[model samples]
Target: MDVEYLHHGVPLADYQLTKADRRRQDEAAQVHEWVQRQLAKAPPWSEERWERMRQLLGPPVPPWELQRWQLRLYCGHVVEATRSRERPRPDGGVCDEERCPECGMDPAVIVAFEPPANNHSPKSSRFARRPPSDRRSKAELVAENNALRAELKSLRGQA
Candidate 1:
């Protein structure tokens, strides 16, 4: 008379045991099972830990404000085009429109023109180009710094 081991009300031979199952006979399987149990019983993320992570990551970035424009395509189809407020169109506005999908036309006329509600005023120096900067190499910068220091020392000595 043979007595079969029972697994969850089923015969142990018929029941399938995975590597991580506590019922598995192998040493590696037993270790895997212990590890899974340890993980399950592990402590959850603490508020301090969460705060530290947030500090390391810094502040969350604000979502981009998108502007939608109604455009009349050359194919007589009206469609909407969306763009971020930070981006400027060819006309220096945020009303860049895409071509008509139906007719495959390149340019489309804007149906409704609404200026972007930008929170910050446009910079006056936006179009004004700065005078070309004197490009000096690293070696030139070090030489200039040394010369300036020498001149300062000479001036102090003269005083």
Candidate 2:
């Protein structure tokens, strides 16, 4: 791949980010936050464990709050255990599936990927369309259920 295609006219060393570039970075951060919020609300169910999750990740955390200091915590155990005599991903590094930090389950079934960040308030399709995160937290689920019920009643009235 040609590096010039990516850098453009700016010299490799003189790559000072412009205001527009900064704004784009900000936008990306916002979108990522939105995605995380959605995931937190509607964590994927584990068919094997048959449990909501081993533990809750607590209230939503915006990436902006963490800044770059934030480290990508891979799932439980190293992908490989120690470099050993000869191993591809020595020292239990991240695996392909990316399991949990606590439990060694590929994709974790709990932790999920963040979505493209945006400044505008992010709305989950599940909630907007059918409230996929109905029963995440008890309080929120109740609120969602109530809203759904109200909508159903209103629709019935029209009918």
Instruction: Identify the candidate with maximal lDDT.
Output: 1
lDDT (0 to 1) per candidate:
0.46, 0.36
| Residue lDDT tens for model 2, 54-158 | 335455554422211111223213221111112222112332233335564334211112212221111322222334544377887799999999999999999
Summarize candidate 1's per-residue lDDT along 1-159 as a digit string, tens digits.
111211131222233434333222244335556887998999988999999999999975433344343334323465555544344432235333345687764444333233323322222223333334646779999999999999999999999
Name model 1 segments beyond 4 Å from true.
1-86, 90-134
Q: Which stretches of candidate 2 lie over 4 Å from their true place?
A: 1-6, 47-159
| True-vs-predicted CA distance for residue 111, candidate 2, Å | 29
lDDT minimum window of 10 residues, candidate 2 = 1-10
- So what's the TM-score on candidate 1? 0.24
Tell me the deviation in Å of residue 132 in model 2. Answer: 54
**What's the CA error at residue 90 for candidate 1, in Å?**
11
